[model samples]
Target: MTSVRQGGTGPRLIVHLPCAWDTSATYGPGDTVFGLREGEKCILEVAGVNNGRVFIDDVEVSQGEHGRYEWTAAFFAGRVQIVVTSSDASEAEYFASVGPSSEKVADEQFNAMVGEIQKFRASLLLGSSSAALAFDDSPGRNKLDSLVGLARLRLYAPGFLREVWEICRAPHRSLLQAERRVSLARVKRLHPLALREPLIAAAVAGQTSESPSLELLHVATSTAVQTFDTPSNRALKALVTRLAAQVSTLLDTVVQGGLGGELQEEESRRPRREHFLRHLLKETKVLLTREPFCSVSRLETSAASLTQISAQPAYSRAYRHGTRALLRGVEGARTLDHLHVSPTWGVYETWCFVHILSKLAERLDHFGWKAIRHGVVSAAESYELELSSGIRIEAHFQANFTAGAPPAKRVGWSLSRFRIPDIVIVVQSAARLDFLVLDAKYRSKRDNVLEAMESAHIYHDSLRVRQQKPNFSVLLLPAEADVPHLDADSFLFEHEVGTISQFSPGEPGVERCVDLIADWAMRDAP
Candidate 1:
């Protein structure tokens, strides 16, 4: 619970929010969340159009998402004068108000609606296809559609925390303001794992018969290393190690669509390089009109409104972690070459789109779309360059070699044009480099590394390019995940070059896979 004191001609309005549901929780005091309430009268500022004061009916008003001024003030008694200023500072006025609570819902109703929505969405997710989510007209066909707290932008606590921290430290002349932002950001971003992890593990282990525990999804999600700072570096690294497989989806998206597809279109109406997304959007919109089914949803559907609502939040709008990935998969429509596409693989889908968006957003050079507000990026401003470039030299072979044949090899794909691995790594480095090669194996579902190591013979044989040496290779292994237990050695795969190196990427529980790979690239540099 939080409390704030506000000034008025009448008794001070001391607002107490137990659940912290108000936007004031985000912006701090002096925001409208507390200012507008029953029996309140105050002048409301309307400035953009012109400096004008509107006498508001406070009791009848309600607050909007991100819009605080959309409220009324009720003054049964003599009005108290308070200066209301437009966000632009163009308008200011004096007035009075009773107080504001018109926007706050009954706590019980608010929670029930959230529960209902989660339950219903959880049910829909289990279905194999959109057809599986048809309108049954049953009692449970749909859940409560409460407009308040509808779970859109259900912020990750970390996001809120970080935002609060920044707001406090904003460009105010006073350092105190900045300190306040830092405090808020910390609150939101603080690790909730101690409270959340055990439940998440139980959900993962139990496999409940009812709705799939979103807790597992939350675990996978909250488990990500999305932020970076010297202080949080340890936790970030851990998340990266655990979430490495998840991050791969992002790179796979780039391999699919040229991340700059819009930049290469016919040059007549081409905007700036930054406006590439604008072009993509124009193109996608055109496609939506001409080939709607082919472009986004694969199936032809009669749920036009539902489709429109679903597609309104473009693939680019979500957080950097997965927004690009989801968009890329939707636009490119394929997996990372090796994985098969499945309905439940929305993780893979969203993953690809977010990654692509990250790349495209970083490289865009113009600001036209930023002003127009298509609602894709966080702002019109460009994103920082991607810290990690997801690329590698991949050589895959579809055909196995004949026993007596002098080995002829095929390179499925080699990213030599831009990226080349400084060191060729073999899985466990056991296979003779000339005979087989394994990059990195990341399937906890598999019992032992031996299966991956044994399979290397086939991959190694395919790579039989008789180099000067025995073509020995190296396997990159996570030192923390049981490098010792795997009994890996340079000779594990029957080659001198085979080896294992152990180094945990981050703290025990917080790092991601990409962070670990990045660590390897840093440490592995010769």
Candidate 2:
């Protein structure tokens, strides 16, 4: 079991988790988990606001003193998955391993999520119309969400690999033509040398004959050459051959490595990639045959000519876009290690949630509400989405508590001057707007949850007076089952800030969140 030096004054709660749980094997007795004790003061080391969440017996425990709650189950049987994570389907990484210091992560779920996300991403890269809805189509907007990992940026990989396969699938071919050029030189054989009319007459008639011309034979000659044997074509051939070999090697690595066991299942499913590699290898072997006229000098000359030919506008333009994309795709093939080591995807979680929100918005088609504008507001740390009917949703990140004036609540200098709310979605109607201030607390300990509620309250009040619209708020905590709701309401009591405390922005949870927001937005709709 992994162990860190245990010397801290922060309150620590001893949670008795089951050994069968993923991370549970890292700590405690034979069947039970251990090290952390009940009613001991300790603190959970977290990197950022969205680092992790702690749950006891599937129910989330908020930040607080150890004495506040009794851990009677320390000696009993139970389960706990530490470091619960909610991530995008494409890039979900939950936990490491189970131990005294280790926590549980959702591996299977994450893999399934990734598979689904890749399918969608692939469709988008292929220019599918249905996939267009996943992105914001507003003018000057990025084709996809910016808050994504490196994997989604693989538009070039498929195309580049396919090009490689096509190149190797046959003997490389180039346009072959007999080119004729005029020359000025006297040669004994005039048949091969295209003779001018006067030179021909001079050659046909002896020098003593009348009308015999003595002009040096100016002639045009024609030569037949295979374009494929040209240095430019050879260079292209070399590049494709190298790429095919490298791709084959990489595919083997991916298939064999299990990507540290993260992608074991993926190895068997991608038969198409493997199949293409086989054909490419076979074709590359066939095309490597030497041409009859390819002497050392000719080959050297051809190689020298390649640089100039490839640099020309026609060839360069073709390779620039495709080659760069191919390189990026190749790099992406090695990203398995990065996904496993990093604990958090940071604000990408919020971005994933935004995607879910968009899906929910689209579901409102029966109501004649379509997403018209959804894009990142460059000036601020906020993203906005507008429906066809005039309803607008804007999510602000780490927003300050103010509309345009001084502090509304002078409870303390810290709470008064600025209140940090993780997410503040402003849903505006045609005539007016409303606010849903949600604190996306990764961990829902008593102290953290209370602080979030306080901030939500202050933000709701601060904006309510200035905007003069209904403002509701909620404490968004990552948990197993829905936790007991606390008595949190806005200062005006116009709306209640409840808990999406247990639900995450994964699948069903995101849908549930959408239902809640849609119901709230349509509550007073015309």
Candidate 3:
């Protein structure tokens, strides 16, 4: 058995799973260890496999003694946990390790990033849930008391809870309409011929010879009716009922864990948040057992028919007014593949930082959508912002300002090229545009710090506009770095270099930095 110590030197991440049937020494049940990096290698080792199996991210790797499993960390980043389960043993030990690699973001920053992204994602899931509801007032009711975390369970577990609810409540009206089919037979009574075909067929069949007045002349007909028990509706009923049972079971797990109440109680002072959930569950059971059935797909087959039945209005309610369409814009979201997993923490942190900065800063007016870059030659995305004081800020991300045309056509294009800043704040005030470039370095390693600062300098020197110096060229890193002089100066070409932590929004250092940046933007006002 390899005895790996905590916090080993070099770029390494190690987790020691203590020998216990229930290992909660390092992490609680379902809790994950942080500081995972991409493009590295990971190894998992089992000390003893008495009757145990080891799993990583829910995928079984190996079992038995001397079992060593290895995988590349390129595709997997974010939280990693080790689980060892033994049927015939009381305790089992496991150890997982990752090879040295570039330092990823701090744990606090990563958690904050995940939380921020989860906020919007949660709202989308809740909206989808509301759409699945059958009542007219459900949107308003859910707005007052929907638990998004519970709603997100639909993402992790693939099922049709919403579709079941939709069908159970309304039960496609078209399918409910009863149609009668008439057949001819030799029988006991004669009936008025709304349709003469059946009577004529019975007469021609020579039933009259059996008993002249009462046999062939008297046509008997059997009526076959269409109902929910028919094959089409029955198939739909089977599917929805099965899914409802599965979803209800998963919901029970969430309820027992008490996840929904905690999240909902935090949002509202109302004590009945859990009450609403109980009611929903009860309704789900009743709907699943109802005799009448309907197909959700058939309801959505036409735009006009659905509207006539008031079903289309339900989806419209899912979209929040005056906001970007979250759930509606994405295709195949019914299966919820989009919301199933968390994005990489590095990417998420950058997005959260920009979001917080854009929202909190009083000077800035507007910010655009995040543009994801796919290749080196791809054009960088710039968020457009307009200040109340007639200043326009174009915030570029990973842009290479030095790779463009020559100095003859541009101003101060001196450096050779190839510099990509994490965020480049280009302030356009009056006739010139000055830069306040930033690089969001999540890792606290000294070498990475130097590289970030060096890149910031390249951007400042290469992107000069006719003697107009940069307001500030800063490195935005995690708070753990404690880089010196983060809030010292912001004057153009005067102490313009510094560091600002991404986690330092309300902190004195970040407040001071934003104040200085805002003050500098207004300093040259005409």
Candidate 4:
């Protein structure tokens, strides 16, 4: 590990990962430490600063003996930023990349997983053409309330801004023709009608029409001038201006409201967010000063003008996608507010559920199962697929379940208390209803995998469908190395609890898991 000094003064920051093979590394601002495994704990010590505070991913770390601060990497693979602030106001920033410990899984593979999750979320919303999925009104359990604002700034704004720029660069120009008095020499194309007026004026002025002083002679010439003040251009300009203002207001609300502390931590423990906002504001102002935007006479965004904009191919893509992103706001189902700081476990869980549900839907289709209702579950952060074969698959995002709740709200009731499994598959036949509960555990370690299996056992024992235990309960874990302890066949036959490891997108085992569930559903079908 290479040591980098911070400002050539102040304190020296040292990082120690007791779990890793190379246990120690020195880091400074803009430095990244690699080879750290996900779920591993690390220690940070700041030399030369006795009373300083340490923050990892914006959460302050508790000081231990000898002024060492510890933080555990999250279960998912991603990069986390750390900041150490001294009493003298000096700060040093560092980053750590957590990857899968297994040699079988490459670092790119884990990074690609995160990317795929993000893409999946965007596609989910984009694909829902007319689905009325509302934004989250309340703060999420993750406490990042203004996810819509963050999505506007982070995900959608860049592309939208690029499209706006493209429109500004070569905007749709409209030709304007006006009848005005101009010198005879200025008329490039001497129209006969223009000459008639000019000859009449020359005759009145007592001068020869042909050889009259061109400067002295005037003509009623019709001039065609290309201008950027078209209705389409005005509409585009209006949209950009309104979007910029709305984004500014949203940022202010997010920074000053509940998301203040969290966003501050995300912005490098400094005023980096302020700097970014300021840069955006400046860029927007500059964009407005450009040709089309500036030349637009009025910021009137009428329906007809907007329709005109959509008619042209050059402006349609930006207008359509940008308006959609703005109007849809933040999806409560896929909250990406904290993705920059840390890719939360909920994201991984949702990805696993979607993957399994998709594969299962494909298998069911092969068996001639047609979807009756396939869309987002109303008033909830989940997607449901109801097949013609009486099988309903639901992928929930942190939905709650309680024994006292209504039947429509509860996927399955807990005999003792409440249970909220990550994924649930309920198959209702004419005779009986069979349930398959799946809990996604983002752990790859042996101990963690075993601990997560307890959830499966608990769900299998407690959750009941029509006063009966689920036919099968499974734990979906990240890696396959440590889950050989729980045999799938015996657990399903005797205990009704099992584990499916390495159940990720594009994994070969995904098909097998989907097949197993499909087989059970087919067997129970009426």
Ranking by TM-score: 4, 3, 2, 1
lDDT (Cα atoms) of all candidates against the true structure? 0.27, 0.40, 0.43, 0.62
Cα error of candidate 2 at position 436, Å: 1.6
Model 3 over residues 1-526: C-alpha lDDT tens digits?
A: 3333443222122233323223222322333343335554444443333555555433455533445455445322333434565576332222233222334444454444444434433321222111121111112112212233333332321233444444456553433444344333443344555337654655556654453343234333555443444443344444444434544554554455443323442334222224434545565466546645522323122445334334444322321110111112222213222221222433443553454455535444344434433212222454555566677656555555455443343442324565556665556767657766666665555666766677667666665435554667776665545455443454324666766654343334456456556665656655
Model 3 RMSD, rounded to 1 decimal: 14.4
Which of 3 and 4 is ahead in TM-score?
4
Across 120-177, the per-residue lDDT of candidate 4 in tens digits comes to: 4432222111011123322323333344454446445667778888877788988899
- In candidate 1, which residue ranges exceed 4 Å CA deviation? 1-436, 444-447, 466-470, 473-494, 497-526
Question: Where does model 4 exceed 4 Å of error?
Answer: 1-73, 78-98, 103-236, 256-271, 282-295, 300-344, 358-403, 407-419, 444-454, 461-469, 480-492, 498-516, 524-526
lDDT of 2 by residue, 37-128 (tens): 22222233222224334433223335555322222222111122232222321111122122111111133433333334334232122110
lDDT of 1: 0.27
Per-candidate count of clashing residue pairs (backbone under 3 Å): 72, 18, 1, 0
TM-score of each: 0.20, 0.41, 0.49, 0.56
